[model samples]
Target: MHSKIELIDMSKKNPGEPGIEIIESPEALAGQINKAEVFFLKNRKVVLGIGGAILVAIVGFAGYRFYIDGQEGTAQNALASVVYDFEADSLQKALNGAGGNEGLLSIADNYKGTDASNLASFYAGVALLKQGKYDDAISRLQSFSSSDLLIHARAQSLIGDAYLEKNQPAEAISYYQKAADYEKNEYFTPVYLMKLALAQEKANQPADAVASYKRVVDEFPLSSEVVNAKKYMGLLEGQVGK
Candidate 1:
């Protein structure tokens, strides 16, 4: 985006022109110090032009930062209103908006770079999931990024569920594995593991399916997943036996 300009002047004459020779560094010419001054002026002009470009770049960057900050503030306020509606169990109002307040979907669509906007995407995804709009939920949830391990894990698991409900066993298994391994928290791990086991079985990898279910029984014995894991494992083993 940034560039510098330079000029090179090399002058020479044909040797046939009365003992003429090549001239190197015209600035070093015997009696043309004045010409050298002109060359220096040209270099100065180029440097000044580069300096002006740099100044404009700095001003542009400052203005962009200001614009982004303003957008972030607006998005935060919009998201707050949506959250209030959501907490009141007014799901439609939270997602589609009401009166003067913008909803989570609107904020996510228009102010994607803001923190509140990112959270809006998550909220939108969860709302869609609750409404059984699985594909739409997956799109929004996958767009959200967060450092919160629990939320991230939940999103991954939800994606797995969506895929599973759609009968896409391979996709379901991938997302389930991501959810199961993401934060390694004891609470959600078994749930995701069971989902993965079911998905693997659907994918027809009976051995891998059994292994996944066995993990829940062995490593998460107290979890609710353990009961279903045992059942699923038994089913897979029986199929293999046949």
Candidate 2:
């Protein structure tokens, strides 16, 4: 039997009233369910996006660690081999290497992205310089760069020496200035300062030459370059007044 329904008086209601109604239609109910499912799907997408980002981060970190560890290992081994040849003064063997062994050139070529390769480039430049291949030395040294202050400064000094050997006094002076400014250490600083002063003298800039020599003598009196600096300073001083 149908349940009994009760109705309150509605005579006080305004005209054209649509009356109170309850939503029980099947299609309307289906639409509500569809909306709830859509909301859940949207939330699922957000969760998936966050999970994907975290997964990418984890994978990237692992890959970077592996790459760094591999590079470090390779660098240690490569440096050891090169150091042996360097100590023995085996320039040709060091650069070319024996069969089944890699040389500095191989390291520089095969491991270009690694720090060891960068160091190999430096050694190659030094080797070329020792062989009196000034142009090749300059090219190799100029192409190598590093963030390590000492290494970077030494490279610039080596490049300056290459230019000096090539009889390019102006270029040598420029590179010497760069080396001196790169590292504020007692060891290389005075040496580069002396070179700069000498180069300035060669370039006919006696005033600049005197200033550079004075800097070496005043700032690094105990350095080996200081003695030479003092003599140059005296000569430049005498010339300045004339």
Total backbone collisions, model 1: 0
Candidate 1 lDDT: 0.84
Which whole-number lDDT from 0 to 100 does residue 84 have in model 2?
84
For candidate 2, lDDT tens digit of each residue in 1-242?
A: 42222242434445554432113234545677788788778798887889999999999999987886787678659777776886688987778777567888888777766778888889989998999989988888887999988889899999988988888889999999999998589988998898888888888999999999989988898899888888878988999983
After superposing candidate 2 on the true structure, give the runs of residues whose Cα lies further than 4 Å from its correct spot.
1-72
Which candidate should be chosen as best, given lDDT against the real structure? 1
Stretches of candidate 1 off by over 4 Å are 1-61
Clash counts for the predictions, in order: 0, 0
Number of clashing residue pairs, candidate 2: 0
Per-model TM-score, in order, reads 0.73, 0.70
Worst 10 residues of 1 by lDDT: 1-10
